[model samples]
Target: MSQRIVDHPVLGSLAARNQLRFTFNGTPYSAYEGETIAAALLASGVRTLRVHEEKGTPRGIYCNIGHCYECRVNVDGVPTVRACMTLVQDGMQVTAGTVLPTPLKKGGHSQ
Candidate 1:
């Protein structure tokens, strides 16, 4: 899928802005200065940002706002960052939720 918004019904043609580089699970992607992490990943055709800590259910951006934590991910060693609320920065390292430590076990045991 193309990782760009060529034209918008209301916004018209999106001009090329200063491009920034970031990696998702070691795969590189380009993003603009003002684009959110969720927007960038979605544009790149990435639907799953993380998984359920205990159930292993796939998770992505549920709410574009910061309220929902479904889009939580690891950014530059920091964990539980909301992708929809976080802005993409140049040279940022993003990892999937699968790599994060599970807060609880199958039997509700703290790990």
Candidate 2:
């Protein structure tokens, strides 16, 4: 399942640029510089970004914009980050689903 836009009718073949290395669910994948996290995942054929916390239903990129929270992911231990809005950074560690770092309480203790 190739997700990259090989040859567009109007734009032709997209030129490859500087590649960035990132990990998704513990697996390493390459992405171009300036590409969003969601775009990188889509290019790598990762259809599902996460599962619903309560219902456990699969969730992907519904809205490419930041309006919908379906593309939420745990990035570098940060929870609930919108992947569609975040750019892919080199050596970034992105995890799917609800495996997030525990939030801190008012007293600086893990909740």
Candidate 3:
């Protein structure tokens, strides 16, 4: 079941749009045309888009706009792509960002 707002009080009925396929963390999912990556994931019940770089905390759509970087996810071969600002593309590959281990956590740096 999709969680899209089909009928809004002000926007009325939702217009029919083309459905496209995309992959999130190797899982194939469908998204509507012109919808952002964050929107698609949220509609699919995916809240945690990535984890904190150091603290390992789960991060999801915070601002919804392009201001906050909490919704950053890896797209294709790119890293740190803001999911809220990027539109979902057909066959696009998206992966959740993982927290990088610090020097102290990685055997106190390679020397």
Root-mean-square deviation (CA) per prediction: 2.8, 5.1, 2.3
Cα error of candidate 1 at position 57, Å:
1.0
lDDT of each: 0.87, 0.86, 0.91
Tell how far residue 38 is off in model 1, in angstroms.
Answer: 0.3
What tens-digit string does per-residue lDDT give for candidate 2 at 1-111? 558776578755556467789999999988877689999899988989998875578999998999989999999999899999999999999999763333343554544
Model 1: pairs clashing at backbone N, Cα or C within 3 Å: none
Residue-level lDDT of model 1, residues 55-101, one tens digit each, is 78899999899997999999999999999999999999999888435
Select the stronger candidate by TM-score from 1 and 3: 3
For candidate 2, the clash count comes to 0
lDDT of 3 at 22: 98
Tell me each candidate's TM-score: 0.83, 0.78, 0.85
Error of 3 at 85 (Å): 0.3
**Residue 21 C-alpha lDDT in model 3:** 95
1 or 3, which is superior by lDDT? 3
Q: Write the residue-wise lDDT of candidate 3 on 1-111 in tens digits.
A: 689887679755546677899999999988888789999999999999999998898999999998989999999979999999999999999999998978867675898
Which regions of candidate 2 fall more than 4 Å away from where they truly are? 6-16, 99-111
> Where in model 3 is the C-alpha error above 4 Å?
7-15, 103-111
TM-score of 2: 0.78
